[model samples]
Target: MAYDLEEQEQIDVIKTWWKQNGNTVLLGVAVFVAIVAGIQGWRYYQHQQTTQAAGLYEAFQGAVEKHDVKNVRGIAGQLMEQYPRSAYASRAAFIAARSNYEGGDGKSAKAQFQWVIEHAKSDEIKDAARLQMAGVLLDEKNHEEALKLLDSKHGAGFDGLYADLRGDVLLASGKSDEARAAYQQALEKMDPSGGYRGLVQLKLDGLGG
Candidate 1:
């Protein structure tokens, strides 16, 4: 309506500034909105994947409970192929590996263990997979490979288990002295009162350590 002289000048300056920079401001706002929406979409997609993987994992558990090794393996394959990034995928693979190992399918078990070693998100999971793989190798009489694998760096809390397995591999390989040393290390690293400690002690005693 009516503007003082100074007010009119200020308004003019604002109009000039808008004409020069309005398009840039609009573009920046649009890009920001797009980025925010993209982030929300990505989050939603991740949530959906986690939910679906959880459902599949429940099914995998049911099969495991029923001792349906075939179904367990098939579902594990699907989880691994479709939701490789999900925690369920690695857990499923771990279960499948154990199932195969127990069922005398060392080939499939070893393959799954290798997959976990390569793809597991958790250090503990990778360590467990490595240990199971060593067991498979020991069964196959691949003592040297098993020893080499056990020698690899393990995560915290796995030192004792690795040492125990190392002892087993050494004993199997006819290295009684080394086996005794490994078993002694296991006894030292393991929990003082853990149930497994007794077994390790027995092994050591068997070797007269």
Candidate 2:
């Protein structure tokens, strides 16, 4: 509210209020400044974490490309321990999982895949992790566990792969009819233009009528 500067009484009232409340007002200002500084500090810390995690992920990818499975696993473990929530951590885990699997370390591969499935922010990444984990289970000939993993909810785009893997599990379990149905469902889910369609068709043909 505006008052006439000529009002001496209002001026006197303002001076009295300020004398009583000035310290409280100053305290509020100090608190606001501290809060803003704290936010900036936190943001800077997060940026540093992300930058470091990214550098580590680059190193991990390089290791993967060079087929240095030991280095890949080491870097991935560091990321998981130090920056598990960072975006790069999950990606590093994915690469490391593949590396370990190819290196004949199925147990390490499963653990890394589980980490991605549990910690990845993206549903697509989680879906892919589950798919790969199921594949590992299939390789172990743990058909029931593989089927359970394959039957879990996945991304729509993953349906064909899920179904195909499911068919494999069923066939291994000695359920030819269920395997045939799953193979058919895989064909229906797959895109006709996809090169893998021919592979799935071959599987279906191999199953025979």
Instruction: Give the TM-score of each candidate.
Output: 0.94, 0.92
Clashing pairs in 1: none
lDDT of 2 by residue, 87-128 (tens): 788988998898889989999999999999999999999999
TM-score of 2: 0.92
Candidate 2, run of 10 with poorest lDDT:
1-10
Worst 10 residues of 1 by lDDT: 147-156
Q: Which clashing pairs does model 2 show?
A: none
| Tens-digit per-residue lDDT, 9-89, candidate 1 | 999999999999999999999999999999999999999999999999999999999999889999999999999988999
Model 2: residues with Cα > 4 Å off, grouped in runs? 1-8
